[model samples]
Target: MFAASIKSKTQSLRLQSSRLMPLSQQYRAQSNLSNNKSYWSHIPSWKGVSNDEFVSYRWQLRNTVSDKLKLYKFLDEVLPERLGSTENEQLKRIRTRTNFIEDAIAAIKLAPMAIRLTPHVLSLIDWNNPLDDPIRRQFLPLRSSIIPDHKYLELDSLHEEQDSPVPGLVHRYPGRALFLATSICPVYCRFCTRSYAVGGNTDTVSKKPQKPSRKRWEVVFEHIANDKSLQDIVVSGGDSYFLQPDHVREIGERLLDIPHIKRVRFASKGLAVAPGRILDDSDPWTDNLIAVSNKGREMGKQVCLHTHINHANEITWITRLAANKLFKHGVIVRNQSVLLKGVNNTFTALSDLIKSLSDINIQPYYVYQCDMVQGIEDLRTPLHEIIDLDKQIRGTLSGFMMPSFVIDLPGGGGKRLVSTYEKYEHGIATYKAPGLPGAKGEMTYTYHDPKPVKTAVLEEFQQRQLEALERGETLEQFFAQSAAHLPRSPLPNPSSNQNPLRPQTTSTDIVPEFWAPTPKPAYAYSQGM
Candidate 1:
């Protein structure tokens, strides 16, 4: 009984560490069909909605099968004639959108036992032909909004010039490297930035596109072996986790052998699109993942997982359960979101995403400006809006939850921050530090203030702080004394009387007087917004 209780408590702690409550007991809460069947039925299944309604619903159900297909069709039909005549001659007016049944079967046949399929999977398909608005109301999809084309253009240009250390590898950052581990994804998105790497398109500019073979991975390992500066490697492809568990573990074990490579992370959206792949007990692949993650932990290397989840709704019960499995087995999870137009562009949407990620114990790390990729011009929200959204999100959520808004600089220059309202420059910004209002020596203060008056405020507060200390007052008592009176001496000692630790000086010293704060160039300010 005691051992069982201990096991229960340990499991509970493990769930808590993953930043979500125990979900094994909450499976019933995640019925996808319970309230969604009716909603999904009304959205005009792949048959296509009217042009007006079709475009309107593009952002609304960006992730859904019907919605993505419609958008792809719209682009195929409209973009070439409307915006760029270049794309017109290349393809048909409405290119066929591949459904899961056909695509999954094709993928399975290519690599037998690569992935599992259940009979219930077919039931999950929406075969109903009728459009039902009442049922659609239950899903409450994202609102529609316009985004610019430059976002993808910028991402393309940046990545184009970046040096490829090996085939399918991007080594832009100093300490970290990105490996395009594969070209296959369980589900393909039209806006995928790694266009060349995914969907079996091997025309990546730098490297020759050949069929993925073990020999190629060996080269990747060799590159890592020589690069002493590269301490972290991010395994990303169309989706690294989409590879068979043996393939995944093989990469993990190979990465583990590199003593200098302290961290190996898999960047994927698989957990969102196909959580079953990670959790099904009948699948040997699941055990392989667990083994890989455990081996990573045992080797004293950080086994991290960076998943892409754009909205809160995507964190279904199955995803939560799967995340717990990864965490309990010792893989840390983090989320990197693209700030796409119409989808999570608002503060509320961003906040909810952050909160949900935090609730599941996954750190919300990067709120990236959408990548500039072809056919995704409509998805880029303005950078300024992302800045404002970041401002609103800063105080509302925990530091871990609030992700940094950044735009990968054009021409592969590097990532630059999309400035928030805080206007932080040169790593100099102020927040209300410790101490309460009206506390003796405590006063309204500006942190990192450049002016003398602001400097005097800190000085006076420190003086009073010392005097209060000599009186044998505890730090709490000192703050209370400064805070005791009703806002009197709104400006405490302008000199240094507040703190007795140092001599009071009225005139500001020129030589050592004011710390010359680093001046932020105008271009830095202009770039973020």
Candidate 2:
């Protein structure tokens, strides 16, 4: 009887120990969806709104903060401090019709890509401190972006245009083909690799048409269908989620019809920028997504949704809800993030982001080094920093949660593992891309330091130009004379409105619209009213 009592005590002790352990280690870990968190509870605008209304994707889209005035009004209400003394001065300048700051802001808007912010994304911002807000940094415009620095960077950083056998499809890899379905995004990221193509940039060097027509799509489909070697197809654009539900469904159906096509993945930022596009039960797009996913499942093919989420802060409760809904519908979700300086560059930031994604059942895929895209020199971090950060975070997280640090080699050379750096020197690192053409030699890349640009340096440069002009030299003559000695690309002519980089084209055929069925009024979809 004493032995029996001891055995009972031992069992009780074991049970207690098990209970003391963290819930994650206690059993097979499930998704963090079981934990309830209300991300939108703090929003004043959402107050007194029904859950149905709040969750409605259409409501989110319809109420998107598109205009500068709307954005200013929202920020004023929430965080009056954002438009502090400096912004107030700028506003005063605008009210007085002064052209200083007003012209600067106007130039930024007119330069290629325009500003676009969804209400759902805006709600994620900490209005009190927007400048430091990761979400705002990714979407909001800056005057520095208009400045012509980082002349070394190419307009087509990845050389995507060269790799494209067709206008809309990019076949960079052997078996995979990327289909540019639409050239529109819910929110335009400031550091977009394809900024030249998307957002209606008429000033791009590559004169390739923005969106594909019905005939162009047919040709693309034929190319994929004919190539049996191609098994995986990535449907992306400004964002594939921007496409209508029927269009997405049709694309999937067409891909499935190709017997060799084993996987169809949709690359979109909507899951992060605009989750309502997928989560709203009332929206027919969600139903169409489910139907396409189900069809892929029945055919024994992989249908996945790959999202671009850079920062940990981007993963909100609403994002999780949208992901969870997709999960329930048997769609596999994954995340790919760009490793931008001051963004997700730190070990702590990346760790939190990867952990957050894993918790939501979305696998962290790739942490790509910021591409050598023009106008994004401020965002790019050095290769050494990225490598060190990757090492620091690798062992701390699960294998699936850890992302591969990769760099897409310039001139269509393709993505290379950043770990295999052939050489490192003074601000220059050489990497040997896997399947690049010609000699298998390491390619040298230069990355600038993260220090802020000195105002004096810019002033000095401008002062020299003014001095030359005062000496009776024409601005064009001055620039032309400077170009002979300088190792930089020639600056665009200020006298001509036409972009010198843009190829002259005479084609006048109307391309088929990919967003909505019927043509809507310009005000309905204009970036900033």
Candidate 3:
């Protein structure tokens, strides 16, 4: 009877697997539109350009729309007058308000991750409706970035620097290492996690580290070579692809030489932002990548390309072409996306994105909660919302299509499954997980809103004031009565360490309290009073 039960379970598992196989195959078939000329014809910029020039990676790089002025000129030609005028006004305002310090900071941040959008990606923007365009939102700077409320946000949100033993290499996970190969990309994302470092900015918000030199790289390679435990290495930075093709090949070869290194993964947004770089067979970069993949195959090691793409609209004909090229070279392609609030946060948007990736043979890997980087509060969604969205979409997506919704805990705690909220209270959720750095046995983390939390007392004060007015009390009388009942205390000296609102603990594990307002008297309210 036990044998029969085991047989039944195995059969059930096989049946489920078979059911999922066909859906993936079907999507792959639907995604192949190489013969579809109509789709390419609709892009206005693609008109008058021969297929050879359109597919040339060099041409794409040479014609990138880099500066604000260049982007404006392109928009002026393609967008409606009204939309163009609005964008121009916003840009003009930003330019007018720029000061020396602000300009210095912007220059610093943009240095490592310079803005350079290829024509193919530029054409993907819906110029008539740029406000809601996910692609546009990802690359373009916004006015909300200048808001002062974001001062409390951390410059190094993930504390990646704290985990790094070397200048370029971050050995965070036990078996995996992160190699920051370059500090450049085709286009700079406004919410880039490494905005403090990657761009060639000399004046960074965080403690700026020196650029990785050949000598520094030698030290990094030596460190990896000496470590036997590390089996996987993630080659990334501004974008790994931004490194010269020969340099990329050399890095891959060096990693493969390390006996314990079983897998080497390259992370880049270039596949989506500048597909022609790898899609064009004539491009030297494409050839070099192919050679590297071939070498990895020879060594019996896994070589993969993990591309960053947030929206389904980003998966275009060129993206598919690039993915297919990598596929042919025996490089497994996957996607890792950030769950930006207005970007791909909804179930429908995420569903479409993963499905589109699956259609092109790109496995959906991780959907990370946006980090608490300074000036990026607008992009982050509440943890509960991210968890709910994951739950809503889990049952509907194919197992391969469902990416893990993860949050890298602040202060080098490593990645945690966002769904693992052990307890929720007062807009704060507690997550307990083992093996977290600096945690003692089942470490508990508290996640709260970045915005100021309104205390119950404050709410009650407002409510009582409203009720007093309904009873026909004058504003002065209400204030006078309230003041009479309130408790008095000696004002704190500016130099004292008597802050009641700040966390009093000495433990480094504590998350700082977001509220820092002056203390108020405790209030007691009775139902009939």
Candidate 4:
């Protein structure tokens, strides 16, 4: 009887870790969807899947919408016949499901990062409003929306390859090295800065991947062991989440064993894109992560997870539970978001994301300016967007809750403050990173805004993208050929639009028509909206 009481107490404690007593219940009652709703059921094919099967990591992997064939099949089933439109002129014309599928297919052919989507991310997309859905914009690109690449963009925008002394290891900073553990991710995003190496080869970019293998990692591990100046290591690549549970344990334990290593961060988007994996009792990934964090604490060192979460919609009740479970077991998690043009560039969108993450105990770490990477010009906002957003978001939250608005500089210059530019004229801004050592610190890195487009020629460029695909031309060749034809009227200067003394007009402020979509009156059918 005494043993039974102990077991009962333990179960209650577990519930406290895995469930938000008041908030979860309230959310469930409102959505009738978050806690017990098999939201995945909305997908025609997954209609019969139960909550248990949907939560399993194995099941998620087996059902991942990978490659062109699987994606086309899934989109056909999930997307409504009539799609909603967005104010973004580039995508406003895609009003039907068939049009969207065609654009997606063409975009996949030219995109640098390959198309890969998890069930969770797929489920989050408002398929009814497929064109403007922020989640769709991130993972699946639309060829019709493609714009000419920024002149400064490169396939390997960060110069990770040049910075590597050994394969799969980037030693850009003096005291730290980024260990490329695996060139694989649960889901691939359109704006990945590591476009040259992160995903399976797309037509536009052939990946030189760092496959996840113990033998492959031995060289990276050895280099860290030998380097006395290295105090920090970030295990990232496609993502650390792709690393096996045993692999996570071994890598974390090994890094902790390094004599001079003071901090270790495993970078993964798993928490955002595949939160169910963390909550799955049958899976050991989170268990291994917790073990690593605990071991690091025992050794008087720090081990934490650095996740990428761009928008608030990405955070569901499942994500909250997963994050809570990690926190309950003492895992330190932080989020870094890219300030995309339409996604979280607005004050309301960005603020909502920050608060949602903080509520789940994930510290909002860095809000990055979208990197000037190849083939996703539509996503990259001008440098002023971040500068403006950084100004608007300050003091709205506690100092700790606020994130640093930063730009990871183009061509190997590391992350720097967005507002710290040496010069700003037209669309180009220049910055110097003196904190970096040697010649790097002395260099002035320049960042360019996405090329401003004339409304008259938007359709012309769209035609060029599809024509280039038909001719079997690479995206690089297409951009090079199309650059001179693109309109280049100067965008308004950032200073002219703002007054620090009063309330300001930020880019994110939208009219009723452009504001986020509301649920349909009768839920729009299909087990309903």
Candidate number with greatest lDDT: 4
Clashing pairs in 3: 108-201, 111-199, 111-200, 112-198, 112-199, 112-200, 113-199
Using lDDT, rank the candidates from best to worst.
4, 2, 3, 1
Look at candidate 4 and tell me the lDDT of residue 316: 79
Across residues 337-397, which tens digit of lDDT does each residue of candidate 4 receive? 9988778889999999999999999999999998877677788888888898888889899
Q: Over the stretch 170-231, how does candidate 3's per-residue lDDT look in tens digits?
A: 88777888998776777777678776565543212322433436787898899999999899
**Clashes per model (N, Cα, C within 3 A):** 28, 0, 7, 1
CA lDDT, candidate 3, residue 166: 75
Instruction: Tell me how far candidate 4 lies from the true structure as C-alpha RMSD in angstroms.
Output: 10.4
TM for every model, in the order presented, reads 0.55, 0.74, 0.71, 0.85
| lDDT for 371 (candidate 1) | 56
- What TM-score quantifies how close candidate 2 is to the native fold? 0.74
Ranking by TM-score: 4, 2, 3, 1
- Alpha-carbon error at 196 in model 4, in Å? 0.6
Worst 10 residues of 1 by lDDT: 129-138
Better of 2 and 4 by TM-score: 4
lDDT of 2 by residue, 221-335 (tens): 9999999989999998878877887788889889988999999999999888877556554456666666678889999998898999998888777777778777766789989
Error of 1 at 302 (Å): 0.3
Residues 367-411 of candidate 1: C-alpha lDDT, one tens digit per residue: 887655532334555556677887877887756567888765444
Look at candidate 1 and tell me the lDDT of residue 314: 66
Model number with the top TM-score: 4
